[model samples]
Target: MLDMLTRWYQRRFSDPHAVSLVAILLGGFLTIYFFGNLIAPLLVAIVLAYLLEWPVMQLTRLGLPRTLSVMGVLLIFAGLMVMAIFGLVPTIWHQVGNLIADVPNMFNGLQNYVSSLPERYPDFVQPHQVSTFMITLREKVLGMGESVVKGSLASLVSLATLAVYLILVPLLVFFLLKDKEEMLEMLSGLLPKNRRLTSKVGAEMNQQISNYIRGKVTEIFIVGIVSYITFAVMDLRYAVLLGVLVGFSVLIPYIGAAAVTLPVAMVGLFQWGISPEFWWLLVAYGIIQALDGNVLVPILFSEAVNLHPVAIIVAVLVFGGMWGFWGVFFAIPLATLVKAVWNALPATEPPPEEQVEE
Candidate 1:
């Protein structure tokens, strides 16, 4: 067993570049795992810088100085963020308040409907079974409601931290965008000199992650705006809130869409009660999802990483469990990084005797 382990280690880490790459990767994983909360603003800034870099490059190519380009992009980005915070957030919060106020009515209606299922289908749904299911569901729902209240209170306590992130993130983003090359040079200087494999993986991940972040942000807006417009036109209550949920649902791949469906359906059911309007709303909503999956995703992600569905789902589950929202958001890119590193590893050749036998 010892000999076998030694052979495996030599086969994997024989190259100096491989050792360097492994060391760098291990260090990064350890830092993030240990000090993620401490450096969260830095991470957020890095991601925003990546998202904003494209526009800065565009302006620079159009004869603007790099400093001027960074300023222009940063100003526009900050303005949009301010508008979202001041204008959009309050509306969503109000809608959320309205939804919470209506929850008791909705729950009562649902309980009544479920209770009637036994009478409507005596053979399929027994009264005792319905009673037990209702009891379990009510408990689960009450638990969730209590959790939400606690979360809200916790968020209130963290407002100061949020303000700090808001301030520090933009400043960090500005310096990052302005001193991009210098930062790269400094980081490169710190890494081992024998890092050809690491450089290759870094270059690939740079393009891959940039495209993924920008494309994902664009997808979120497009879906959110379209959903909001559709819900408003159909006179659906809590349109903005639901639209936002549907938009962000793209982050979780298959699971998000499935999960958000319940709220949308419940709201519609309580409002229209199996009427034509409700059916039409559902049909329109379904079309949006279908188009997003079949159309928008392919177009946006054409130049992005091409991961299999199972691989994508596994990445979502594993990384999401590790890093929560950020993990789920960057799961595909992280998985792609792993794949790139593996592919770049030097392949060991068999002995001449084995080659001759073959």
Candidate 2:
């Protein structure tokens, strides 16, 4: 049976191809089946490993042992996690409580706005009523309401999974940090090469991943600081809460930070009215993003990583479908790793490194 199996496989695809196909299908199926329970935490672990590797490498250069270095990384990580939870939980909970308390006020505002809209257009029907000419419109609005409720429920489920991720992240991160080198070595051995090529690719990918991760975290911290200072100075309500959210969202590529600011600013405008405070948020965020784009990002993330904007969108779409927010959050990092692997292929590599463009 073994001889026959070998003959059939050897006559068809290469051994590597056969093994890789099996690995891909099996791993993919398992990931799909256990995504909520397992895959997410594993991805977080990988990303955390990326973030910590630089400090670990730096520690080794400073003459610390690998084990000690890894421990230091874990310590810093734990300290930050504790500090963030302490700082953020109260602010977020406070903001959330305020929102809950203001629900009636918000509904009043919505009702007032809708009333005003009809007056601005006299031909417009009452927002909540149905007349001979507006029955279809009323039905459509009701359907819209149902869709909104469904969307809200979906969002709640996603949020609950995020809570689960918070629980899993640290545990996974600890193990990943401790077993980083061993994992890399074991995975590298499975690569179909004379070992040297695999080792080089592995090392290059590690460096790229580590650099990207550290740079991104530093960027987030800087953005957060800039936002907090601005919001505090501007005297916006829930400024700290919104600022921290903006800072973290900014870690996502392109649209993340800017996307959240619109709604946040609108809330400020609505609540605070069109005063200096109302407009200050827009100006502050605009300036912060400008500075980040022109100075901070270029200085900090010099290598650029060469990911296409189109690639980023596709990744967000694909992974967002599979894993929702997490897929969106970690899409860029996952895409980066996938890109590195794709680029490493002999058929995919541009002639040679030296021959490639500067």
Candidate 3:
């Protein structure tokens, strides 16, 4: 067993590049595991810098200096951030508060409906079963309410952290964008002299991640705006809240849409019951989702990472379990990084078969 293990190590870790890659990956995982929260601002800055790089390059191509180009992009980003904070945040917060305030009423209505379920379908649902379900549901709802309250209190306590992120992220993004080439050069200098495989993998990951993040941001804005207009036209309550939910739902691909649908349907049901207005609202929502999935996604992500559906889902599950929301958000890109590295690594050729009389 010892000899076999030694042979395996010698065969696999023989290449210097392979050994270096393993060390780098282990080091990276350890760093992220240990200081992930502390370095979140830097990670966010890196993502923002990557997203803004294209526009900055376009400006540079149009005869602007790189510094001026980065400044212009940063200014636009800052203005947008300010607008979101001032214009959107307060409205969303109000809607969220309203939603929370109405939750108890919603639960009461749900309980009443569940209570009547047995009468409506006596053969299908017994009163005792309904009672049991209602009890369980009530407990779950109470638990959810308590969790929300706790989360709100926690958020208040984390205001300082949030402020740090707001300040530090922009500053880091600015410096990163301004010193992009120099930074790349410095990082590259740290790597082995013969780093063709590493460079290839890095280039591929950079392209895929940039396209994905930029395209996703655009998709969210487009979907949110469209959903908001549709909901407002239909006189739906919590239109902005639903719109934002629908917008961000695009982040998790298959899961988000399905999860968000319950709330949208519930709100519509309570608002319009079995009316044509409710049906029309649902139809419009469906159309928007269809257009987003079938049309908008293809257009925006024409050059996006081509991940298999199963692979994407697995990545989401694994990363989400590991890092929660950010993990879910970065799932595809992380998966793509894995794919790129796998492709970059040199494959071992099978040993040649020795033939005698055959």
Best by lDDT: 1
Q: Which scores better on TM-score, 2 or 3?
A: 3
Query: How would you order the candidates by lDDT, starting with the best?
Result: 1, 3, 2
Model 3: ten consecutive residues of lowest lDDT: 344-353
Per-candidate TM equals: 0.94, 0.70, 0.91
Quick one: how many clashes does candidate 3 have? 0
Task: Order candidates by TM-score, high to low.
Answer: 1, 3, 2
lDDT (tens digit, per residue) of candidate 2 on 131-236: 4325564566568668968987899889988898777887777667777769767965765554443455556656766777777788888998888778778776
User: Model 1, range 1-358, lDDT digits (tens) per residue?
Assistant: 9978877777778899999998999899878878888999999999999999999999999999999999999999889988999998999999999999999899899899999998899999999998999899999989989999999999998999999987899999999999999999999999999999999999999998999999999999999999999999999999999999999999888788889988999999999998999899889889999999889988988753377878888999998888777789888888888888888887684233445644
Query: Which residue segments of model 3 deviate by more than 4 Å?
Result: 1-14, 303-305, 348-358
- Evaluate residue 288 in candidate 1 and report its C-alpha lDDT on the 0 to 100 scale: 93
Better structure of 2 and 3 per lDDT: 3
Candidates 1 and 3, the one with greater TM-score: 1
The deviation in Å at residue 310 for candidate 1 is 0.3
The parts of candidate 2 lying over 4 Å away from their true place are 1-36, 118-175, 194-201, 337-343, 346-358
